[model samples]
Target: MKMGMRKPSLKKSISARTKGQLTRRIKRTLNPYYGKRGTGWLHPKKKLYNKAYQKTTFSFWDLFK
Candidate 1:
Protein backbone atom coordinates (compact mmCIF):
# COMPACT_ATOMS: atom_id res chain seq x y z
CA MET A 1 0.00 0.00 0.00
CA LYS A 2 1.19 3.52 -0.70
CA MET A 3 2.17 5.56 2.34
CA GLY A 4 -0.31 8.31 1.38
CA MET A 5 -3.10 6.00 0.25
CA ARG A 6 -6.18 5.88 2.41
CA LYS A 7 -9.75 4.67 2.07
CA PRO A 8 -12.57 7.20 2.13
CA SER A 9 -14.34 7.18 5.49
CA LEU A 10 -18.07 7.42 6.14
CA LYS A 11 -17.51 10.29 8.58
CA LYS A 12 -15.88 12.42 5.91
CA SER A 13 -18.71 11.75 3.47
CA ILE A 14 -21.38 12.61 6.02
CA SER A 15 -19.56 15.72 7.09
CA ALA A 16 -19.26 16.84 3.48
CA ARG A 17 -23.00 16.39 2.98
CA THR A 18 -23.75 18.33 6.14
CA LYS A 19 -21.47 21.13 5.10
CA GLY A 20 -23.15 21.30 1.70
CA GLN A 21 -26.56 21.52 3.30
CA LEU A 22 -25.42 24.26 5.65
CA THR A 23 -23.95 26.23 2.78
CA ARG A 24 -27.19 25.94 0.86
CA ARG A 25 -29.21 27.11 3.83
CA ILE A 26 -26.94 30.11 4.38
CA LYS A 27 -27.13 31.03 0.71
CA ARG A 28 -30.89 30.83 0.71
CA THR A 29 -31.18 32.97 3.82
CA LEU A 30 -28.80 35.59 2.49
CA ASN A 31 -29.99 35.43 -1.11
CA PRO A 32 -32.53 38.20 -0.62
CA TYR A 33 -29.81 40.34 0.91
CA TYR A 34 -26.99 39.58 -1.53
CA GLY A 35 -28.47 38.16 -4.68
CA LYS A 36 -27.78 39.27 -8.28
CA ARG A 37 -30.71 41.70 -8.29
CA GLY A 38 -30.04 45.42 -7.88
CA THR A 39 -31.62 45.47 -4.42
CA GLY A 40 -29.38 43.03 -2.64
CA TRP A 41 -27.34 43.83 0.49
CA LEU A 42 -24.19 44.69 -1.42
CA HIS A 43 -26.08 46.47 -4.17
CA PRO A 44 -24.82 49.88 -5.18
CA LYS A 45 -27.78 51.58 -3.55
CA LYS A 46 -27.13 49.94 -0.22
CA LYS A 47 -23.42 50.46 -0.54
CA LEU A 48 -23.94 54.16 -1.09
CA TYR A 49 -25.88 54.45 2.14
CA ASN A 50 -23.13 52.54 3.96
CA LYS A 51 -20.54 54.89 2.54
CA ALA A 52 -22.56 57.84 3.73
CA TYR A 53 -22.44 56.48 7.28
CA GLN A 54 -18.66 56.01 7.19
CA LYS A 55 -16.31 58.62 8.63
CA THR A 56 -14.98 60.83 5.86
CA THR A 57 -11.28 61.57 5.73
CA PHE A 58 -8.96 63.92 3.88
CA SER A 59 -8.79 61.53 0.93
CA PHE A 60 -12.55 61.68 0.47
CA TRP A 61 -12.52 65.44 0.81
CA ASP A 62 -9.98 65.74 -2.00
CA LEU A 63 -11.94 63.32 -4.16
CA PHE A 64 -15.35 64.87 -3.51
CA LYS A 65 -14.15 68.45 -3.49
Candidate 2:
Protein backbone atom coordinates (compact mmCIF):
# COMPACT_ATOMS: atom_id res chain seq x y z
CA MET A 1 0.00 0.00 0.00
CA LYS A 2 1.17 3.56 -0.77
CA MET A 3 0.73 6.75 1.31
CA GLY A 4 -1.06 8.40 -1.63
CA MET A 5 -4.23 6.42 -0.89
CA ARG A 6 -4.15 7.10 2.85
CA LYS A 7 -6.21 9.85 4.52
CA PRO A 8 -4.57 12.50 6.66
CA SER A 9 -5.30 12.77 10.39
CA LEU A 10 -4.76 15.49 12.99
CA LYS A 11 -2.27 15.00 15.82
CA LYS A 12 -3.61 13.15 18.83
CA SER A 13 -1.98 15.78 21.05
CA ILE A 14 -4.84 18.14 20.25
CA SER A 15 -7.75 17.58 22.61
CA ALA A 16 -11.39 17.09 21.53
CA ARG A 17 -12.49 20.28 23.32
CA THR A 18 -9.94 22.36 21.36
CA LYS A 19 -11.05 20.84 18.06
CA GLY A 20 -14.73 21.61 18.77
CA GLN A 21 -13.93 25.22 19.69
CA LEU A 22 -11.82 25.70 16.56
CA THR A 23 -14.56 24.29 14.33
CA ARG A 24 -17.18 26.54 15.93
CA ARG A 25 -14.99 29.62 15.51
CA ILE A 26 -14.23 28.78 11.89
CA LYS A 27 -17.94 28.26 11.14
CA ARG A 28 -18.89 31.56 12.75
CA THR A 29 -16.44 33.57 10.64
CA LEU A 30 -17.04 31.71 7.34
CA ASN A 31 -20.84 31.23 7.54
CA PRO A 32 -22.92 33.17 4.98
CA TYR A 33 -26.10 33.48 7.11
CA TYR A 34 -24.47 35.31 10.04
CA GLY A 35 -23.08 38.41 8.33
CA LYS A 36 -24.34 42.02 8.16
CA ARG A 37 -26.13 43.88 5.30
CA GLY A 38 -22.97 44.88 3.38
CA THR A 39 -21.39 41.46 3.61
CA GLY A 40 -22.66 38.32 1.86
CA TRP A 41 -25.97 38.96 3.63
CA LEU A 42 -27.38 41.28 0.95
CA HIS A 43 -27.33 40.80 -2.82
CA PRO A 44 -28.92 42.20 -6.01
CA LYS A 45 -31.55 39.43 -6.14
CA LYS A 46 -32.57 40.02 -2.51
CA LYS A 47 -32.94 43.77 -3.16
CA LEU A 48 -35.21 43.09 -6.13
CA TYR A 49 -37.35 40.74 -4.04
CA ASN A 50 -37.62 43.28 -1.23
CA LYS A 51 -38.62 46.00 -3.69
CA ALA A 52 -41.32 43.79 -5.18
CA TYR A 53 -42.62 42.88 -1.74
CA GLN A 54 -42.88 46.54 -0.71
CA LYS A 55 -44.45 47.87 -3.95
CA THR A 56 -46.95 45.11 -4.70
CA THR A 57 -50.58 46.04 -3.75
CA PHE A 58 -52.70 43.67 -5.80
CA SER A 59 -56.21 42.79 -4.62
CA PHE A 60 -58.51 40.09 -5.98
CA TRP A 61 -61.62 41.70 -4.40
CA ASP A 62 -61.18 44.92 -6.42
CA LEU A 63 -61.35 43.01 -9.71
CA PHE A 64 -64.51 41.10 -8.64
CA LYS A 65 -66.25 44.13 -7.15
TM-score leader: 1
**Model 2: residues >4 Å from true position, as ranges?**
1-16, 32-65
Error of 1 at 61 (Å): 63
lDDT of 1 by residue, 29-58 (tens): 977553455554546876776555443323
Considering only N, C-alpha and C atoms within 3 Å, which residue pairs clash in candidate 2? none
**Per-model root-mean-square deviation over C-alphas:** 18.7, 20.3
TM-score of 2: 0.25
Off by over 4 Å in 1: 1-16, 33-65
lDDT of 2 by residue, 1-65 (tens): 12222232455435546886787678788985553456533577876765565455433333566
Poorest 10 consecutive residues of model 1 by lDDT?
53-62
What's the TM-score of each model vs. the native? 0.27, 0.25
